[model samples]
Target: MDTQQNTALTRALAEVPGPLPTSGVIHITLPHTDRFTVVGNHLAQHPDLSCTAVGLAVRIQSLPQGAKVGIKALAARCKEGEKRIAAALRELEAHGYLRRVRDRLPSGRIITRTVFCNRPAALLHPRRPAEAPPQPAKPEPAPAPAPVPMQRPAPAPVCHPTAAPPAPEVPVAPVAPPALSAPLFVPRVPPPTAPKAPRRPLPQPGELTPELDRAATTFLSDLHRHAPQFTLSEDDVRRLVPGVAAWLERAVRPDSIRRTLTDDPPQPLKHPAKLLAHRLTELLPPVPPGVDALAALDRPRPRFTVTPFQTCEDCDRAFRSPTPGHCRDCRETRAAYAQAAA
Candidate 1:
């Protein structure tokens, strides 16, 4: 009895070690409930991709449509440098997992659109998925035997003097024809390439007036206090001053410019400098010519004729005003706002 008990204990201890793999992986995965991304083995386990590229591919696949996957954006999120991230992206493009197309807007703005494929092989060859291990075939049951009709005893043969043998009958084909189905297809339209626009350099440091330079510098510096994401380094501030100067030179009020920039900012802004650059360029107002441009810069910008919805600071009441500030009653003690140029 003691020997039997010892034998059982030894067998159980040995079995515990047997279940453990000598090499390879052990997974403890759970069903994803939310905030999960589906990645295919093609991208996840590519033989050619480096560890960084494979990781980036997984991250890209998991991202929702329209999400930014640029090298700079990815570098910001991951520990990799911009050059490293850029190289990884190139590797992915070469392997057919990623495609970047430069597209142009009617407004003459160019944007690079990135397309990601979870399974590149399946896209190139539709039947490639058939290479997966086939499932075990289920056993088919034997068909039931056809029932036999009972044989009627033959009637006694009647003999006729002039009976003619029946003419040979021809075999007829089956009535129904085989069904045919059309093959499935997925159509992909390539984005149209836009002609490259000539690059325009920003106004040089020497061209901007000292006053305009000061205002532009202060404007960028103040953004950090109100909107932390807009914080700029000294070099970035210097680099971007020319953009802000362009706005100031056009008779734009510092207040309005600040409001325009700070309003409805993107969440988790990756590159504030780039964001400012785009807004400064695309939102640039038409440049008024010569004497009129100089005259416009001398005075406060004209107010809108139509009163828009506004919330007052003093009373916190919603009211219609051409600009943001205290309502009429709250601002009665202060000087009246400028009316439209007449």
Candidate 2:
């Protein structure tokens, strides 16, 4: 009856989704030794050990005795950040569950070895015997020596010499004083000064010469033909003349500027002057140093070949080949027709 009851309990446990389902599979069962039990029960509940710290400890224990461990490798294996793993290792060291010994080899190399412990270090090894107090060294006695005798010298006699007589002194004449004169007058000279250079007059607004006026008129006329809505007044032309002159100075053709402004603006422009100024500054062609210097010599000249005109099939109007069979207006009309049909 006991054997039958054991078989029935095993059958029920096999149906559960856990390790018991694969009990026959190859496994290394760790013995419930004192160190293992203490690590699972006591270290897991340690106040200083966080969940991450406990998990790291378990991972370290599962490894072989002398296997290498690094913060990066451990973090990758545990799917945690390096900083968190480092913090966990530091906590383990602080709580005595880990020890890191650093030593230098004779080759002048330093290395660190990490030792994982299931229990505190004090429990693993016996306390070292207390060291004895140091005592002072004894002094040695001095030895005696023999004494020596003293000696004396003799005295000398005194002598006398003959004396000489003194002579009389002679009289001298008195000296006279010289007369003083008045001081001489002198003139002071001033330093030479440099002449001031004349300043050139600043160009006034709308101050265009005949040639510049003609160029400005032609540019304005081309711009007006392309975008009739963007009309420039006399003052506007005056404000924009410098930018147009800059383009001309760079040897940019007026036709190129006109085509650029007209050919399919990226978006519907509300301000033409600002766009023109930006284009004139950014897209201005390079100017050679002298009239004899060709631009093509420095760099290849950009090809701007005009596309062959194609007649629209629907509107019967000549248009560029970008739309192929239909012009812009016809394409919009067809789109509207399709929308209506839909």
Which candidate has the highest TM-score of all? Answer: 1
The per-model lDDT (C-alpha) reads 0.78, 0.68
Give the range of the ten consecutive residues with the poorest summed lDDT in model 2.
Answer: 182-191
Candidate 1 per-residue C-alpha lDDT over 62-145 given as tens digits, one digit per residue, 9 for 90 to 100: 788999998888988999999989999888887777887789999999998898877666554434224678799999999999
Candidate 2 lDDT by residue in tens digits, 96-176: 677777889999999897877676634535445689999888787676665565564554665656655665666666655
- The TM-score, computed over Cα atoms with residue i paired to residue i, of candidate 1 is 0.32
Off by over 4 Å in 2: 1-40, 124-342
Each prediction's TM-score versus the true structure: 0.32, 0.27
Q: Cα RMSDs of all predictions?
A: 21.3, 35.9
Q: How many steric clashes does model 1 contain?
A: 0
The 10-residue segment with the lowest total lDDT in model 1: 182-191
| Colliding pairs, model 2 | none
